[model samples]
Target: EPVEVVVERALAAQAVGIDGVIASGQEAGPIRAATGAGFSIVCPGIRPGGPVGDDQKRTVGVAQAFADGADAIVVGRPIRLASDPQAAARAIQAEIAQALAAR
Candidate 1:
């Protein structure tokens, strides 16, 4: 769906008792327009800034995700496929902290 249309979906979901949306691509910008109204945004396919290895090209870095108004993020492939899963997890955690601090 077009980014703008996702906002409509978010609104519709809220109308039906849903509480959030999994924003991606440029949808975050539009989603933020609904900010004061209240709702959560969880961005998936979040990676550490590199060539997106999987089909979910709709990806964003940790900082950018937060900057774009993601309430939370789902880190998958990156940590699971990392040479050191523990370090990758920690790195992502640190990135999240930095992003939150910046906010």
Candidate 2:
């Protein structure tokens, strides 16, 4: 969906008392602004500098997601399909740590 549509839906969801919304990283900032700091924005379609393939279209790196005001990020294919799942998870963790530290 377009980022504007996602933001609109998020705002509507918040208005109706929903605690959280799932949206692309691009919409997190606007949604957060409209809904305030307490509203949870969980971003999916995260792709950490790799092949995007076909499933997801609006993907962002971990750091960018956080910068965009995502309260949490959901990653799937990168960790699940990696040859070494543990290492992939660790790498993502490191990135998240670095991003948090930078903030």
Highest TM-score, which number?
Answer: 2
Prediction-by-prediction clash tally: 0, 0
| Residue 4 displacement (Å), model 2 | 1.9
lDDT (Cα, tens digit) per residue for candidate 2, span 39-84? 9999898877633676677788888888778889998889999999
RMSD of 2: 1.8
Name model 1 segments beyond 4 Å from true.
Answer: 35-37, 50-54
* Residue 57 accuracy (lDDT) in model 2: 72
List per-prediction Cα lDDT, in the order shown: 0.80, 0.83
RMSD of 1: 1.9
Q: Candidate 1 overall Cα lDDT vs. reference? A: 0.80
Error of 1 at 78 (Å): 0.4
Superposed by TM-score, candidate 2 places the C-alpha of residue 89 at a distance from the truth, in angstroms, of: 0.4
In angstroms, give how far residue 80 of model 1 lies from its true place: 0.2
Of candidate 2, the 10-residue stretch with the lowest lDDT total is: 48-57
Q: Give the winner by lDDT.
A: 2
